[model samples]
Target: MLDDIDFKDYKKKDDIHGTVLYPAVMVAPVQKKILKDIISKNKIVSIFDPFHGSGTALYEAFEISPEIHLVGCDINPLANLITRVKLQGVSQFIFRDIKKIEDYIKKPDGIYEYSFPNIKKWFRPDITDSLALLRTAIMDITSDRNRLYFWYILLDVIRFNSNTRSSTYKLHIKENDKIESMQNTVIDMFLSAAKMNVNKFKHKSDNFILYKNDIFDIIKHFRKNTFDISITSPPYGENATTVPYGQFSMLSLYTIPEYDLELEGWELDNYSIIDNRSMGGSEKSISLTDFELSLIKDYLSLISIRKQKKVIRYFKDYFYFLRELCRVTKKYVVLTLGNRTVDRIEINLVEITKKFLEKNGYKNISSVMRNIPRKRTPRVTSNVYQKPVNSMNYEYVLIYEKNNVTPDREFS
Candidate 1:
């Protein structure tokens, strides 16, 4: 039935979906429909997205049923900020906050407020000055919720004005000519984004909590069966070779104040810190079972011996999350997976995740493979991991129902 629900023309009937540019996001309309179906079956449905990329699923869950509790977390600070601001909703003082920014942008009396290593490499001097002024304006807003909304809108503006190539998630520099021609007056772009998104969050919803911590850190505090459903699109591959969400978010992260991001003081230590800390960022290998290794064995055979360790460890780390996920959700786990090639081979993460979930007491009740008709990535389809290509075709949406069997917690 999910396959029958065509998301090809989900024109974002509301303008909220595109306020920020995250590397990978769930299809808003499709996610809403999925939540609606689940909510229809159950009287009260609480939702959680461990990865919470862009907070798309959580926002959709909030929209479909405003009163239901929605919980989400991500290791990416930018993601947590976006999710928090989104679920925080537009404050009553939104207009006052916009006016505050408008007034500050006119004079920009605040001094340059940010500095990170090689800031000049990604942002020009004038662009940094301009961004610093805008960042000051966002920080000056009276309310944290409104301030967060402006910060959420500022992300794309930073990406747009940065010297980094907007084409890729990596921090590759743009051509000199392109850099020279970049926008110096970034306030116009920021203001435009603010206006587009200003009125969308008119109904303030406070029924959500967001965390900017590792999945385990958040899950350890949650009791068993804390959520009715968990919907998320976990990272397809290691951040270095995959979507690089941390890299994609770095420009904006650097521009915002550390206090606003609720930093633990070392998240911005280097350009790759967040990526290096992501799911498969670790180079260390974990012990995998013969049964677990058997799942990806065929793909590992053709992949280089050195690359095999990275692939093996990524899944093992992912399994750790799935095991905890199975413990928390009471009813269903909804996952949206893509066909990004892991090491030049189109990896079937959906099938692999299905097996992993089954090992944790869930049965794949519904599986839907649909064409990704529109993507903000390089093309209208999903990305070709590591190496960009033009042949990506389908994204699998899987729904797993909790079964009576309790999985053995033998693989710690």
Candidate 2:
């Protein structure tokens, strides 16, 4: 383990990741530092991130190790697209592609290109019309790679124009008066953003592979010991409770052409489908009450039985994922975790993860705490009482090394 250190020394602004917005992006320089250290200690060939939100870790790894194989996945199609575009890099003729966007807008279809429940509530009519026009133009792009970069830029445009308040991650609409006053600047926003974002991802590399499936499902196709290292920042808590990544992304997912995304088992009929499929969100997964951790028992004892169920369900899913993640990874695992609030109490995820990894024949090597720098997530407000509070003040990056022995029971 390295000596106690401050992340402030290694800090550098993200050039590529900032081109598009994503919730809870791992710090790029720190991720690079971790990957660089791992590569120096061992001969690194490939890296994996199951929860590759916006591809922060993979992007940094790519910057350092251009030849290293990169693999990552996220349930959100928008995330998949963002990371894919980042790894593939934008074409050199990105400006020419922007000029071509005008060609696709032959004539307005006079109707929205897609539909979902209460779509009108989230988007003003004029805004919808302009977006549809832009969507058509993006679709007209002949090359899939160029089309993807345009789509990546459009995600921010869609979110900003939507009636949903950009101040928070949850899908709460702005006041009616505010919505009515909004302008139809979709075309302008898309054009300016496309030009601005095109240059951020111009370093082309094709060795990386990104998946858009649940981590467990994606692991099934992989043989044991496939990746040399795994670097990921899993969600701090259940999606509904913390950041509703699915709900926050609903507008973009629905707006982007389904054919382009090539999504699997994603039903747009309900907005909460992605969040519900998230960890601890499924009904069947929630009913598993046999969590065999003393840390869990001690923590649950302090909270009400009602809230205990939530904690139990989330960890059941988390522990299951941890086992599978360790099984597939060969040498090292670096997890950046956060302790989030549950019923006004902090859940010690850092300690919990250390203990859990130990059960799977692993030992902690490095643990460092870093204050979140320029975080986009606002001071979290409770939906129940409309109260805002400081949250997720810091994050812990825990590094673990796998022991040689394979077989051990997971719990006491």
Candidate 3:
């Protein structure tokens, strides 16, 4: 570990390459600083992120402490793939393989042959053919790491080459005129992205361990007190109508054959599966009285009956997630949450999270409200009770330290 180096002095070297990897609400740089500050207070030997998202938290952690054992879990395969690539570090073998793929792109052997449902709707015919060719070439690579690296490149290609508008999370195709003006080809985009990533990832490490499974399923595998620090930003609002993470990633996820939803027990096939399985995605009901945040109850009463259930269900999942986090985290957990609106009523998620954590044997150290810089999420305008409502502009970072007096319980 670079104990002599000042972690606070370090700054991001490549923001563009980092943000383009995946589209989820990223933990802001300031929030990362808050997490690092908390980590600095303790002897941090291991780090965990239950919702890895684009793996930015772990990436920052590794940058601060290269030898720290890092573990992350995310339900999205694309997230898992991106996290693994980021943590595993780029190798010379992968770079050489990327070079070979680049050379082959100059003189392709056969016509593109891959197809999937709704594929043409998202991609122009020519663009589809080029992407298929790129996919085949990437697959031909012998190394798994190299294949994943190229696959990551393809993800960027799909997003740029697709007919979908860049601003919206939902998969809405651009107007015909906009589509006609788009001149970038899949191969060109893929090669450019690959080159940029290769240049950025010249240095590699092997300290990270990632899992492509649900947080609940994967948390069971970890023993008690396995992590020194945990930092993450869980999904906010109703997954279906709010932030459709799975839907946003459909174009990229469809390209990976292992994500076939038709396969038994394949949950990823459903486009909204990630959001549907997210914090508030379930249909089960919970008593409003069970929650300590009266503001949540007030918001529930203000929103439509249907949305009320979603709010309650989300907290239910949120509560369970906190319990698991409390069980595994040995010292501290940093949670960054946004205060979204339900029927124009501000739901202070940080306050609710604070209550939940304190109840689960965690001592709340502090809650810092931070302005969201460069918010990537498009402003959501939804009809609640036939009136328009918008999400909040700021988020809060809640720092919680595990109460040493309380013993860790086995997560059921």
Candidate 4:
């Protein structure tokens, strides 16, 4: 039982160093024990994270047993880049190179020439020039892995120095005075983030195989039952309205050239494409009757017509993702998910997920609710259909074991 597990005392302050360097909804360090405990019980030899945001779950797996093989995939280039660096680990030599590169970046005489549609809106002219200098220096690094690490640092620099409101994941600008008064230089923020990461870096021997493709596409590369355990916290509800991960990351994605390869001639004008391609972004209509879960039906009835479609779309994509997750896992699956609200209606995602897993031939082992002491999500109430609704304060840690019987539906 979770009551017997002392999560409070197990807290490690330094564990967050590498994971929190770049922002997304991250799995807390203390909560990692839930996954670690499951891995220990199953005698797991391999681990996989389909939505490998910052590689927290896989990182915990490596921390538990460094010899375990790790596989992860995310559609976001920045996410892939950050996770790759965290798993690969850094060396003192890389820090030395970063220091040298830092010294080499001198302020340009004129505005650093770069064009993104909202460049002037998000950042000050001087700040943009400083960021361009850092970008150039980081690009000069010879090693792909090391360059990625520095790019992650630059991501932090961009986020901190920008005019974007820090309180929420969705992009919104602060007041002009507030933006103008901010004084942190790009070089200082980059060096600070890099130094902290370098000091905390721990060398590991795990085999990390990461893919920059969508989860739906990457699942095909693995044969059935390739992974012993699958652990992840997938995006909850509609990503466009709820999280806006792509918008939060747009500044960094636009500034960093390495991201351009995956983006394929991405311009600021097509920024909506990122959110549009996210999990719930598919517009294909799903019948409300298609979902067997009662909670989904109840919520669908309460939400507005537009919101009902959004909910249906999110669940449809999630169902397909879950099917693929079951396909690749041999034994255990651990999921950490938050129940969010839409149109003043609380969506019990955890309960719905449990029902879905049971229908798909997995037996529920345990489900525990844990308080989120710290997270990237805003604490304020969100406006849904012009009605104010509070965000999720707690999350569910659900564990399930794959049954030997075949599922009712084919994953393919």
Measured over all alpha carbons after superposition, the RMSD of each candidate to the real structure, in angstroms, is 4.8, 4.6, 5.2, 4.7
CA shift at 247, candidate 3, in angstroms? 0.5
The lDDT per prediction is: 0.79, 0.79, 0.72, 0.73
The TM-score that candidate 3 achieves is 0.87
Candidate 3: stretches off by over 4 Å: 1-13, 16-21, 259-265, 284-295, 385-387, 405-412
100-183 per-residue lDDT for model 4 (tens digits): 686677533333357687789989988987887777777777766677778877787898899888877767899999988999
lDDT of 3 by residue, 1-412 (tens): 1122223443344552353545545544654576567556666889999989878888878878888998988877777777777766566787688778887777777744877678888888888778877877887788766777777767867888899988777888899999989986787777777777676665566888887777766786778889988888888776776677778877887876563222225554566776676657765453434555463676677778876777778877676677778889998888878878876787878777887788778887666665554445655567766877766566676778788733243211
The reply for model 4, stretches above 4 Å from the true place, is 4-13, 16-24, 28-31, 106-112, 202-206, 259-269, 284-295, 384-387, 404-412
What TM-score does each of the candidates earn? 0.91, 0.90, 0.87, 0.88
Q: What's the C-alpha lDDT at position 359 in model 2? A: 78
Candidate 2 vs. true structure, TM-score: 0.90
lDDT computed for candidate 4: 0.73
Query: C-alpha displacement of 153 in model 3, angstroms?
Result: 1.5
